[model samples]
Every structure is written in structure tokens, then in C-alpha cells.
Target: MKYTREILSDVEGYVPGEQPKSPDVIKLNTNENPYPPSPKVIEAVQALPPSALRKYPDPLAVELRRACAARYGYDGEDWVIAGNGMDELLALAVRTFVDPGDAVLTTYPTYTLYETLVRLHGGRVVSVELDGAFQLAEAFYSTPARLCFLPRPNAPSGVCVPRAAVERLCAEFGGIVVIDEAYVDFAEVDGEAPPHCMDFPRRFENAIVMRTFSKSFSLAGARLGVAVARPEVIAEFLKTKDSYNLNAFTQAAGLAAFDDYAYMEANAATIRATRARLTNALRDMGFDVPASQSNFVLARWNGVPSARQIFRALKERAIFVRYFDAPRLDTALRISIGTDEEIDALLEALRAILG
Candidate 1:
């Protein structure tokens, strides 16, 4: 039963942010989009033909790719590649262009999945730890990896590196830079931060920008995501992916989801507003709230009970949030910004826990 590779032998797999199944707990885990996707997503799927189940989905996902390009303000279908999720694309990206022994660097405390992907490929996973300020490590400027994984608003901390930093990497470096904009729409604290790489990566052939239907699009269940790159990279990824990785329903749903961007935009606005309220409230309650630019707040209770204690207390009250058991992040809780009512509920429960 040891068919697993050596990489699997000792390596701990990436833990997802968390997804509690209980209906009672206000699930503030797994940075999932709290709102439902566009109504068109529902309508499109409802009208999907059952006959599709009999045949395999389009291996290329041409139409869905086209819709993605259009959404990103691109000219044609050449810039986009669809995936079961951006996660699949991440794995494929490594296998496609990365050499078995090449170095793949990513920010520490980022989507850990990136590290797991590189390790599984027999590649060296070099992490440049974010300094105490939560910015890119100096290693990024001093030495660059052949590939890098970056979440635009980043993760857990939900802080973004400056655009100057990204441009500096793209200019001085010689490898493909992948920017994961999974939560960019929710990354603005007051509309004064970095721009989404998707909004401009077409200008740089070496830069690859990824977008997901999971967060802002609110289609986590649909599991659809797209990566935008120079036409050259798209062709390479096409050659690397499973011929039929995306199903027919996903294509229909993703297309419809784009058609109803306004619906998703409305929901994003609500999350932003609520995120601000919670950040401020947490600060008032003596927590060191990091400036969150995503639909979540990262807070460390000021000399209060440890993050583990707060996590357990909330669990008993049926409220779920993400707690990373790593070193600097040990005391911090990454709370997904939910609906106003959900935040209120969490606060009410917290009051009791601390008292």
C-alpha cells in the first residue's frame, strides 16, 4: 500500500482554511464567498440539458474560456484557461513549466497548497518569510525563484505587496510570476491599495494572473477558476491539463456567473462593509487587527486567551473560524468576514467567552 511517492512519505499536506459542516456555527472559516452566485448561475444550470451527462464535457472549455477573457477585458480566447479550480491549475503549472529540481518560491503563510504542489513535483520549495510588517521578504529582491505563488490580498494576513514590488519582480526576474487574485475584489480597505494583477498581466508575458469563482464569485461548489496569461502560457497549460478536467455543468454555470457580475459585485460590497466594521470592532476589543483587504480579518487577542482558546470557545458556541497552528500566526485567528448578522452573532458569543 506504499504506492505513494517519497514526497508524500514525510510531507504534511496543505490544510484548507477550513469548512465546518454544521448549520449552527457561523462558518467564518475557508474564506468562502458568503453570498450565492449570480441568479443566472441558477437559471443556466436549471436549463442545462441532461443529455450532457451522457457525453464528456468539452476538454478545451472553449466557450467558458472565451467568457473569462471577455470578463478580464481581453481581446480573444487565447488568454484564458479553465480548470476544475485554480488549485488544479497551480499543480499543472508546476508540472508544465517547472523543472523537477528547480526552485519555486512563495511567501510564507500563504496558500500552503502552493508549497505542497511544488514539493510533490520534486522541486525545492523555498519560502521567503514575510517580515513582521507582513510585506514581501527581502529574499524576493535579493534572489528570485523560477516560479512563485502569491495571493493578491495574500492569505491569513490578507495583506498585499505593493505594485512596485511586483513590477520589480517581473522586470528583474526571468521566471513566470503567478499572482493569485482569489480575493482581490474584497482586498480594498478604503480603495487605496494595489491593483489586481488580472487587471494588467496581459501587458507582461512573464506574469500569470489567476481568478477564481470561489470567493467573490460565490461559486465554491461549482469549483471553477481561470488563469490569464500571455497566449504562449495558455497554450502550454492546455498541453498539460487533463483533456476533460472541467465538466459541462461547470462551463454553463461559470459562463452564467460572469453574465451576472453585478449580482456578485453587490455581495462583495456587503462583505467589504462588514469587514471594516469587524476590523474596527476587534481593534476596539484590544485585538491587534491586521489591515485585512479580503473578506476576512486576521486578529490576535491582545494578551487575552490564546487563539486556540478563542477557537475552542467559539466552537462550543457553534461559531467556526480559521486558526492556524503555526509560529507567528499561533496567536492570530483568521475570521472570514460574514454577513452583518453573522458578525454580530460572533461578537455576542465572544463577549460571553471572554467574560
Candidate 2:
């Protein structure tokens, strides 16, 4: 007999981007920061006490929350909560708000992990299909779910929905809306004052914004994410979160990284520049490249050497990019912007493959 819950009988697990072992491979599959973490973060990690590992981490992550709250202009530590990663925080949101047989809403062809998380909680997934331009359909506002997760500058496409539209949705949707802004840092990196949805929680009582230290902060390996919400909502999230989810070392690293904001901003500026160059290069090579606000661009080959063929050919040449076989994404490869050298290598490999 199977020793599994009824929900497990037909559920498919989330598939993370591949992490190949070969050091020589030019990996651009996962949206990891090609740059190293801030020097201060490295110093903090190096300074962690070995004895701290023997004790439990602060369950509330007070200092880290304070730093984050200050950065976002939040009133107090009660408005923020840290997680092992955005993945964990997403899961926690589902568990806290979605009951069995309840509904979870999101856009079709999003992060994909959102669907898996809802299914794992035995919640119904109501996916709103994006229109021909990959924009959210009007019906999205009417979705009656217990919770909704929306990714700005959505994945697999790298297109950002307008801030006004998101605000309108938050005003219309009855239930909780979680704005996943894992890539918002990229969109606003070069702007003098980029509009962030973090303030949505204050405006609409039912909204929350999620962020990560991975993409723009160059801390993918450190695995830190946080949620910004109203104090009352954060209190409930704290009730659902696992104790000691953020370890002592990670807290130290996050604090150090947050302290050195200028360093992270410089790296983000570099990525923004590289992303623009990469998008233009792909378009020049006859690929359908969209306007990307994220660190990655989705390039689709409409004719010769389809996406799958190009993906395989690049892998053979020790270059890696992400190719999804799902609907609406089968013909495109999502390429994360690496260093200038790496982007040049990928472009050269693509040229050879196309020829």
C-alpha cells in the first residue's frame, strides 16, 4: 500500500532550474546573480561564530526584520517576516490562507511553483490566461480565490504588468493578494525612483509583497526571502512559519548585505545594462525578444532551429539556458544575463547553432 496522502497520488512536484556540475559550463538557466555577494556579506559570513550553530536561531529574525522594515519605510518589525527563501514564504502563505478545497489564483505560465504549492495544500488553482500580448485578462480581477499570487515582470516571458493594473486588481480582488516581486529590483535598478508595490499592503488591507536576496543581491546560495505586509497579516504569517527557518549565519549575511545597499545597487545596474544588450542582440539575430524588465530575456525562434534544437545545441557547447516544454513557452528559451564575457559566448554559440 502507498504511504501517502490522497493529494499526493496525482500531484507533480516543482522542477528547479538545472545546476550542472561542470565548472566550465556557461550556466544561465537559473536566474542567479552572476556577481558575487557584497564584500560585507562575505565578511559577515566569515565572522559567524561556530558556537552559534549549536543554538536555535531567533524565531522572529528581529534584527533582519528591522533592517528590512527601515529600508521599505515600514513602521516597525511587525510588518516584516523572513524565510529560508521566497519558496518557503510562498508555501507559508498557502498554508496560512488556503484551506482544503479553497481556491488559489494566479496568472497562467507564471513561476509554476505557485501552482505546485497550492496543489500541495489541496487548494484549487484558478489560472487566468494572459492575452496575446501576455497581458493579464480583465477576468483576473473577478477571480474569487482565498489567495492570489502575482509575479511582476512575470517569468518565462520577462514582461511586467503595469503598476496601475496591479493596484486595480488589489482593489477589486476580495481575498489576499501576494505580489511576488523577485525581479522588481531589476526593473527599478536604473530608475531614479522606481515604483514598488510594497506600499500596496498599506493601501489595500489584503495585499502583501514578497522579495528575495537572491537575484539582485547576489545571495542565491544564501537563500533569504522576506514578505512585507500589514502588521496584523504578518502576525498571522508568523503563526504559520516554522521556528528557526532563518539560521544565525543567514541572518548575519542578510544584515551585512542590507547594510551595504550601494554595493548591491551597483551590481543590479550592471545586470540591467547587460540585459538590454542581450535582448537587442537576440532580436538582431532574428529571434522574437520581448521588452524585459528582469535580469533574463525570453528569446523565441520563429523558424529555423527551433527553441529545443537551440537549447540542445548550446548544451552540447557547454552553454546553458532554460527551455520549458509547457504551453505558451515551448518555442522560447529564457536566457539569464550573465557577465559580459558570458553573454558574448552565448551569442557566439547561438550564431554558430543558427548557421
Candidate 3:
């Protein structure tokens, strides 16, 4: 009974977003792409012969990495590594770079999984809280940690840090800096290009940028995520990740999804449009909604019905959204941008509840 480690006995684990099984639920609590994956993904999965499962999958996921690299101007598999999901890669980053009793850093109110991963490795967490504008504080640069996890277009709040800020951080930080761009595809940052930090790896040897097929590519259930960095860092990650992390089917599906990039782009465009409409509607209804660059909006209204009341009211109506019960986030609701129909339903529900 006492065989478990002391840390395991005392630590509270990370809680995932709810996945209600009911078909009629609006189901927007997690930021899953409401759109389906490209037709190619479906075809690839269907074409996978049953016999292929007989053997162990390719340990390196060579072809899938190459295909993903081609999109970002990387030369070969040496620059990237795939994982079961971003969660796995996050853990891998901790294992590969952080030592027991070392420190890992990230912004406060970010993806909580970073802390969990660090804790699992017996590393300490150094959280730098964002300021009144929800941007990184000037003092953030001074916090020293061995590995830094920065989510560009951060989660929960869905606000991305500026490119210059990131460059400065990478320049000054002594250790590794990972720009988690899991939601970057959904962001149209400069009006001309997709919001991303992929090029950072080339600019700074200590920089690593990670992406996932879950959001824009509609492969959340597929559990596919990739990270790009210089060859040396990538080699370290390869040593840390599981040998068969990317199974045969996932590799196939990811390749097909990559080949059909246009499909994902179109869906991302639709999501951006819906996000704009939803944000405007929420603001019009007296909610303080931030300018979201990701597929979700963080809204807080202090008037009539509080955020918690609205969360409960919506749940009673079979509509689901994310409401954090922690400090700095208790008053806000992170609502994922669903399809046009789903957004309409949510808006109608909110209108009725507030009225």
C-alpha cells in the first residue's frame, strides 16, 4: 500500500475538459474543431489494410514527419518529431530537458498540463502572471527556469503574445524556449499570414515550436502533434519519446491531412469568421469579450447573471462551455467557436438566459 512514491500520493492530477456522451449536447467545452477532417483522412484510414497492424509501426514516423516538414520549409525528419499528442510531447520536453528538482516556467493561466508534466518529472514550476491587459509582464523576462513553455495564442484566454516579445524572450532566456502553437493555424495575426512561430527554431538554437493536428486539422481524436527544432534538440526529443508513439494509422491519417492542407485552411477560415461574430454578439450582450485569435473566446460579464450562473443555466439546457473555478478565471467563460449552427444555438440560449 505504501509502495507508491510520495509525490504521487500528494499531487493533484490535471483535470481534462469534460466530454459528455450525450449526442444532443452542444459540446463546446473543449476546443475541438467542429468541422470534420479532410476527405483524404477518411480515405487513408479506410485504405489501411488490417494486415498492417500485425507488426510494430515505424519508430521514427519518417514519411509523416517529412510531409509535415514540407509545409514549413524544413528539409527532412531531422527537424521534427511526432508524438501521440501535444500532451505527450509536452511531457517529453520535460523529460528531455528538465532534471529532477530543476525548474520549468510558463505564463500563469496557461495550459495547466505544463505544470502537471513538470511535476511528474519532480521539477518545480515557475509561473509568471500576465498583467492587467493579459499580456506578459516586464518582470516575466527575469524569471529563470531551465525549460520555458510559452503558448502563442495562449489557451483559456485565447490571446497570443506578440512576435517581438517572443523574440526578446528567446534571446534573453538562458534555457530552452518552446512556443506552443497548437492554435496558431486558427489565428490570422498579420492579415497576410497564419499566426505561427515555426521560424523561431531557425533563428534561435534554443527555440522549439510545436504544432498539432487537433484544432484546425480536425484530428483531436487522432491524437497527433509535432514539434520543430534544431537537429540537436530534436535528437533529444526522439530519445525521450516512445518508439511507437505515432502508430501506423496515425501516421497515415496525418500524412493525408497534410496533403489536403487546403481543407483545413478553409475550415480555419470558417472558424475565424464564426469567432468574430460570436465575440461581437457577446460584447453586444454586455459581456467583456477579448479580441480572440484562437478558436475560442474568453468572456466575462459582471452584471445580472454571473459567469457561474450562466454556466449552470447553459448546462441545464444541454449546451456546454468551459468555466474555470480557479483564481483569475472564475468570472470568465471560455467558449469554443463551433459551426455557424452551433454558435447560433449557443447565442440563442444565452439571450434567453440573460433576458
lDDT of each: 0.83, 0.90, 0.90
Per-residue alpha-carbon lDDT of candidate 3 for residues 166-228, written as tens digits (9 for 90 to 100): 999999998999899999998886575575788888899999999989999999999999999
TM-score of each: 0.96, 0.98, 0.98
lDDT of 1: 0.83
Q: What is residue 17's positional error in candidate 2, in angstroms?
A: 1.0
Across 5-39, the per-residue lDDT of candidate 1 in tens digits comes to 76788667887755666677689888887777888
| lDDT tens digits by residue: candidate 2, 121-183 | 899999999887778899999989999989997887888888899999999998999999999
Model 1 alpha-carbon miss at residue 231, Å = 0.7
Error of 3 at 206 (Å): 0.7
Q: Candidate 2, overall lDDT?
A: 0.90
Query: How are the candidates ranked when ordered by TM-score, highest leading?
Result: 3, 2, 1
Decoy 3 TM-score against native = 0.98
Worst 10 residues of 2 by lDDT: 187-196
